[model samples]
Target: MPSTLFGFTITDHKKVFAIALPMILSNIAAPMLGLVDTAIIGHLPDAIYLSAVAIGAMVVSFIYLLAVFLRMATTGYIAQSFGADNLAEQRQHFNHGLTLAIGLGIAIAIASPWIIDFSLWVVQPDAALIPYASTYIGIRLWSAPAALTILIALGVLLGRQQSGRAMWLAIITNAVNVMMDLVLIIGLDLNVAGAAWASLIADYVTALVGIYWCAKALNWTPALLKIIPDKLSQYLNVNGNIFIRSLVLQLCMATMTGYAARYGSDIVAVNAVLMQFLMLISLGLDGIAYSVEALAGAAKGQQQPERIRYWCKLTLVWSCIFAVFYSLIFWLFGAQIIGLITDLPEIINKAENYLPWIILLPLVGHWSYWFDGVYIGLSLSKGMRNTMILAAGFGFLPLWWAGMPLQNHGLWLALSGFLLMRGLFQALWLRLRWRQVV
Candidate 1:
């Protein structure tokens, strides 16, 4: 018999690990797409190439990441459909998401010129960097359709608990991005434009892979969706809330980066390295959240409230366990990790001062990510929306302003508050009003 924890057998928790392990690795690898681009571009003769790529990558990644609501919304609907054992609805959900993905992608591509101009104007790049940045941005924007398709495809896979497939698709996509970086950026000597093209090509390739995965994974139910006008309205309403939530979350992140910039280049440099640490932790925890989302959605579909409770409690226990380990690992080797990223002595020294925040981060902030899975699975978009607003607007912004005197420390403080509040508010709302709302 397998060992037990918290009143459940290890066998029971395998349900979660089965999904989380591959996903954790995949989530970790996801960053490599951008990292590879930056790494390869960093080798170019002019530092301008690196700066231009960074600006361009940021804008593209921002939009694609924001549209992740497509995945979240799709996952909620798909998992619930899977729970009902209604393969037809699952197929329909996938089709609807794909249709929406393609439409939005084309729309974004057509608007690319205005997007580039507005973004450049807001950013006020070094005058010299504008042409290169604009070039990279323009090229990358065309891949929006493909990139959004990947998100939708991933949603279908994960919602069905086909995480292994999702993980491989992620790995394969990044590998392609890296390979393209070599050919276009290095081999073709295209500089930043080459890097942008690499991403565009890789996105379409991944989109094709996503199509293949969806085809191979689904059991080939022969039915079609008409984009049902009413269904589309429902889709928009659900995802629109999620979009607002995503916007608030991204805005909060941007606010942090802006604050870091105001603190000076050294501070910004330090925060950049530290943000990698944050991103990795968030991504790792997100792996577990994936399992929570699918399992909880299935439980909801089965009309089994107890199963949902079992999962929420179980995930909470494990997340806490991870919190302890994250703290220990970062506490022991945070500096060495910083050294791996940059050789600058000044940045390294400054990074050490803020190392405590990174260590403290997983402990305080991880719950929000963990609970996000629960909320998404239940299709609790409104709760997700409201909590983020409350946390960022009421909690984070005010705290950030009041704590401005402390500089970076203040930023970390406000962020810590924001992260902590997001989960706390969601937990309370779900606990008190879950039945009434859902």
Candidate 2:
């Protein structure tokens, strides 16, 4: 038994690390891909190319993000099923999740034009970059199904405690993306269009490999899937919860980007670069959240409620520690860090002023990130979705509206408030689980 934190003993740190290490690697690879994309695009003759890439990437992230439920819901179901010692149930979870991923992927791909149009409207792309952004987004949209399906399949593997395979898949996928980006963007001089094509090709390749591994690793069978009564219903129920959560979350993000746009192209580009850096921090910390999801869900399914509670306490403590560490890092290296990514001295100067907000973001937002794992592990999808919607409406939108007249400083204030609001709202929601536990 581990020692207590506020009357709850922490679970095995080794266990947490076992799951988190590979996930951390995978998460790191994801942001590195973005950095590479930005790096390759940033070097182009015009900065507007990077801006186009930004809008294009944001469009995909916002629209396709709804399909994320595959991984999110699958992780919880598989974890709980593993804990329950229900191998068949575990298999069923994967099948249903994969099914949902494929279905949603197809639907989104078919409706890509509509989704792209809506996203363009939301972002309100400028005339200079609109054509470039549309071209990039249009090409990338074709890969939507492949990208989303792979995410869910990988999620199932992670839930089954096969984090190693997921990590390998992520590495291979991202590596291919980087190689293709270099070939298409720079070597071939295809510009933003090339970058989008690279992602599209990489996604299909990844999806194919992921499916092969999943079949081999799980020894998947139709009979195992048959064991699940109302499999489709269960999948929809779980997926619906996650869809709502991601939709609201993406809206908040899209709106934040919109706010940055209001400050003009220079601010948008600077913020986009800063956002890439912040992503590095957030995704790295998300390793803990990923581990907690699998471990806690498994514990819950096994009726080891104590284990779930213990892991939660342990992860939260470590997250706070990492937050402080990351803040110090940002403070110490802020100038050199921003300078490394771009030649635009003005953008770097503005980013320096905004660096403090970026540093503070992770620490304040850590709670929501950690609690996301807790909720996913417990399969409390509805509650998670509801809380996000509530937070976006009450906490974020209000502050954003109020700060509109204040310009850049006011913009930073609103965005900071948004991050802080998510933390505060989710913190309150986490306490509600006390009743669920006791």
Quick one: best lDDT, which candidate? Answer: 1
Tell me the TM-score of model 2: 0.86
Q: Which runs in model 2 stand beyond 4 Å of their true positions?
A: 1-11, 33-55, 116-136, 179-197, 222-229, 435-438
Q: In angstroms, how far off is 11's CA in candidate 1?
A: 1.9
After best superposition, candidate 1 residue 401: deviation in angstroms?
A: 1.5
What TM-score do all the candidates reach, one by one? Answer: 0.95, 0.86
Summarize candidate 2's per-residue lDDT along 96-169 as a digit string, tens digits: 77666667777777887887788788778798888899888888888877888788777877787788888888
Cα deviation in Å at residue 41, candidate 1? Answer: 2.1
Worst 10 residues of 2 by lDDT: 4-13
- Judge candidate 2 at residue 56 and give its lDDT: 93
Query: What overall lDDT, based on C-alpha atoms, would model 2 receive against the true structure?
Result: 0.79
lDDT of 1 by residue, 38-148 (tens): 789899999999999889888888988889999999998888887888887777788789889999999999999999999999889999999999999999999999999
Candidate 2 residue 85 C-alpha distance from true site, Å: 2.3
Clashing pairs in 1: none
Query: Model 1, residue 189: what's the lDDT?
Result: 92
Error of 2 at 79 (Å): 0.9
